[model samples]
Target: MAFVHSYQDDDDAPAAAATSLRRMELLLDPSLPQHLAGLALSQRGVLTTGQLLAAGLNRTRIHDIGRRDGWRTPLQGTRMVAVQTGPDASQDLMRAWNQAAALVLPHAALGFDSAAVEWGLVGVPRCDGVTVIVPPGKELRARPGLRVLVRPLTTHDVVSPWGLRTTSMVRTLADLLPTLDRPSGLAVLDGALRRRVRRSDLATARERARGSNGWRQVDDLWELANPDAETPLESRVRSRMIDGHLAPNALQQRLRDSSGRVYARPDMTIDRHRRRRPERGPLYIEADGRGPHGSPGAAYRDRDKASDLLADGADIERFTWDDTFDPMRIPWRLRRAL
Candidate 1:
């Protein structure tokens, strides 16, 4: 933990530039073990082979350490130390992924969906390893557990945070489009909007997105992204509804019982003409994706709120991730309910 410090863009640090291989060899020879250990700690238990060599360690010593129990070679030239809770955990895996990216691609900036998570603009519902967008002249070979995209980014497209270069929020959302399905893409766009990212920013990113694969799909979500969608799952569910040719009456619709008691906001409302009557035409269609529903508190709240509304003569229905993905279920059930 001694070396657990934030990473920085190399251009910002003069002393770090001094840690070049030959310089490191000379500087760390006297304290090889401590220096290497510190580097490993700083990188969330990951250390690069270049670092070991710079630390004046021979290939034989590097091999021995990598072979020790709990160590793993996740990528060429990179070694990950033992995880306290093991590598199966999402938080641990994400930390290691980011740390490894910093070690293996020091000049690369984190981009796309990964950067969105880092900015707290979105949730980590899925992991596709660490994504790094490299500048020109830096060649990164394709490797497992790591994704590298090469492009010349404008200053506006990237930002250095916690010492690591990452895509700016707008650029991250645009870059993230290719990695996501239409539903998730919409959700992320909604998130960006909810976070107050200007629509013009997305337009600029969209201009940059041209000629890129999947640009069309991502761009298509621009019109559908409503800030009213509260969660990624909700956005995805709404996308499915649209695909099935069923549009909700309203987004994030509010409701009150006959007694004027308000309830939780549902993802959308159906049959708008009955807005004045809770027991009639318009009802709520909750997008309780399985991931969120699994949380006891979330589950309790969803059910409790809906049940209370139902008792007061309100109508409600729900769909899960499975239901949305199932080609027949969601559309049919929704049609029947409506």
Candidate 2:
């Protein structure tokens, strides 16, 4: 399948090809190395075959160097190249791939999970392919590690932050939430809210998406989103609890002493009044993701906090990323605790 540039018809192909040839010829000047370096830097070490050609390298030379050197062609059936620089190269691979996609398809805007990444929104799950949305009636065939879709988009729905065209954060959430399951969807919403996305903007996006597919899911998840969720894992756990009919009475509830001095704040709290038995006191749940809770100092503090809460006649439960994989695990354990 051939990738067509925006606004180019069969009649324009010959002119476009000639223009490309002339551009390549001009790029083969003595300053080619500098041009190639700048291009690679701008793209985070990713280069296209056209770029290599412009730098005076033939396809055979490009392929040989790529195979011999540490350079990687991340996207198959495409001319995209990623130069593996260091240990963190894999971390930036997706970003570079997204940049390459934007470069190749200038009229397309990064959408869905890829757009969420560009917007720096948390809780976006890893997707295997890059997604871009073109104007309705545009035809871009899907390639390996790349997803192209045609969707209606207004000028206000797109942005070019850091020079990469991407769907606005609100539009991205509206387009993305419905495609995910409840736990994942709520996590993304919680993450967007945590990033200070206004609820009014989200409401507006939801209303605009009213008649679209997955609109109901988006509407329902919006109501459940909580800004108090500090992390994606916490949001997922809370969502699971809600699904199991054990939504917490309060989130990030402050624990204070008899003197009214705040001592600890748990990730979530369930009042005994909300449980079947009121004699057992409140339940505190801590969602311990690896980053914040894995350190030796953090471990000591957690133990101390647990001791204090236990002494204060409160039941406590701590969960990690693994515990959230099983949808029923948290609810069952909390049920037993209650």
Best TM-score among the predictions, by candidate number: 2
Candidate 2 wrongly placed segments (more than 4 Å): 1-35, 76-91, 258-261
TM match of model 1 to true structure: 0.74
Candidate 2 lDDT over 1-338, as tens digits, reads 11111221122121122122110111122333656654555565567777787778888877766665446555652344333344333434566678778777788999998887776566767877689999878878888788988999999999885677889877887788777777788888887787678899888767766777777755777878899998899998998898889999899988888899988999999997876667677899999988888899999999999988888778998888788789899999999888
lDDT for model 2 comes to 0.73
Q: Give TM-scores for every candidate, taking all chains together and pairing residue i with residue i.
A: 0.74, 0.82
Residue 234 error, candidate 1, Å: 0.9
Best by lDDT: 2
Residue 214 C-alpha lDDT in model 1? 84
Report the lDDT tens digits of candidate 1 across residue range 1-338. 12223332243232123232210111122334776655654565677788878877788977865564445676677777645343224544565666677666777888775676566565335675787888888868768878888878888877775566778876776677766777777777787777777788878767767777888766767777788888877887788777778768788766765787766677787774635543465667888766767789987898788776676555787877667556567667777766
Clashes of 2: 0
